[model samples]
Target: MKKFNWLLMVCLSVGFALKAQDNSMKKLREETAGKIKNAEKDTTGRLWKRGGNFGLMFNQGSLTNWAAGGDKLSLSLLATFNGFANYKKGRHNWDNNVDLAYGYVNTTSLGTRKSDDRIDMTSKYGYEIGKNWYLSGLFNLRTQFSEGYLYPSDTTREFVSKFFAPAYIILSPGIDFKPNDEFSLFMSPFTGRWVVVMDDTLSAKGSYGVDTGKHVKSEFGAYISATWNKEIMKNVTYKTKLELFSNYKHNPGNIDIFWTNIVAMKVNKWLSANVSLDMIYDDDVRVFENKETGVMGPRLQIKEVIGIGLTAKF
Candidate 1:
């Protein structure tokens, strides 16, 4: 009887221990599964990828009783934002980008002046046709958000441009070559481009290649664009883009050119230095010289910007 009682006690202990271990494992599995489900929900089923950054730069100077000459008092501020949304699945891809920049300066002598201004947006969608090649459609818009003036002298300010007074819109169906994530080339044998001048004064002047007294100008053309982006070294990056357009209806032999380059040096997580260069050549756009003489012609337009600023990425 004693032997049988001891054997029964040992069997009961073992059974209880095994039951406790099984319950612990079941609880662990439930917690793990719950965490995974929450993560999936946070990402919204991994449908889209998004990222962007914002930058602000400031410069100021004040000259008091100092003998050294200066602009008396001056202040400048520049703000920039860039963002992108990209979608990729089995055989379809869509990419979208937005870039905005505006800058201004105020001086006791020069008054308030716009130093830089731009609003650019692009969208492209593609379906894979072969290795590293896709059939794609692209749309882009370029404009500004404020009025611009030409200051011939300290007291002379002439209205040169305004929001949508000279806007460019382009649409193309093309073939895109993307051999890697850092480089892309796009070519479209046929494209449509529109130049818009919304202001009555500007439209009446036939600004931005528009017809005389017309608000809009349309052109059919062949377009090509190439882009390159890469990290040159630790905390340093470079990017460049070039685009060409030839109007088949008007001047098929003359091609328009647009090129831009940028270099960035990251000082820390929140500080950076950047430089940018942009150049544009358009046959239809004319630069007026000696308006007193009524002389106008086309010329290359170039701009450059360099600054150190606070930057935030997300």
Candidate 2:
């Protein structure tokens, strides 16, 4: 009876221990489930939206004494990013956007050279005033990331621009018409624009409309901006912007123009292609050679880039 009592006691103890362990595990699981549920909840609120895309592209070529002479080894790489965040609550709305791109190419003979570089950003806040109309204030910036050079020949290059050598800043209080999610038009009677050439070399040369030996210039202008973004078809999207500015105190009839376009085509979940075109004209910036006239003066500048590569969206 003593032995039997000992065995019975030990079995009861084991059973209680097992039951305690199971209860502990069940509590832990419940806590984890609760945490996961809370994490899945939208903490940013329904009025806010955010998205972005990033791309990396590359090209490579090798020629081994073929009939057509070419570089023995050639490689190029390009990276790009575009992002936006928007908030709309009641009569108030705010929008922020950013764009960045850089590219370089290397060849057996030409060495390495910059092929593309850009930086653009914008922020706007608005309050609804009437149907499809809002009183808005906007801020914009444009600059470059690295040194730019003009290649007069395959063996010679002249430094033209660099980081902050030519930076543009614009601020305006405007009326915005936003009819839908895909289009926006903004107009301001008076806009403040600043052109900055921070580099000593570029400042002394009066680069980018800045006065010689001066670092900055201020101008008041009338500004008009229009933007459109939409998915035109399945897996293809188009985005564009057009800007017009006229200096009120200077040659008002000589309106400056800036236009940009981007087209993105989604090939699959991880592959993509893109094309971009940009044009700019400023009356005071006189350094480009006209293709037709072959003269260095104020000329329309156009740039285009096309690439196919890997992409990520978030």
Best prediction by lDDT:
2
Candidate 2 achieves a global lDDT of 0.92
Model 2 poorest 10 in a row by lDDT: 38-47
Expressed as tens digits, the lDDT of each residue in 1-314 for candidate 2 is 99999999999999999999999999999999998877666545567899999999898999986888989999999999999999998899898999999999999999999988999999999999998899999999989999999888999999989987788899999999999879999999989999889989988998888889999999998999899999999999999999999999889999999899999999999899999999999888888787888887887889998889999999
lDDT of 1 by residue, 22-132 (tens): 999999999999999999886754657889978898888899887878888999999989898988776788889898899998999888899889998889998999988
How many backbone overlaps does candidate 1 show? 0
> What is the overall TM-score of model 2 with all chains considered together?
0.86
Q: What value of lDDT does candidate 1 attain over all alpha carbons?
A: 0.88
Task: Give the poorly placed runs of model 2, Cα more than 4 Å off.
Answer: 1-43, 290-295
Given candidate 2, what's the lDDT at residue 298?
84
Most TM-score-accurate candidate: 2
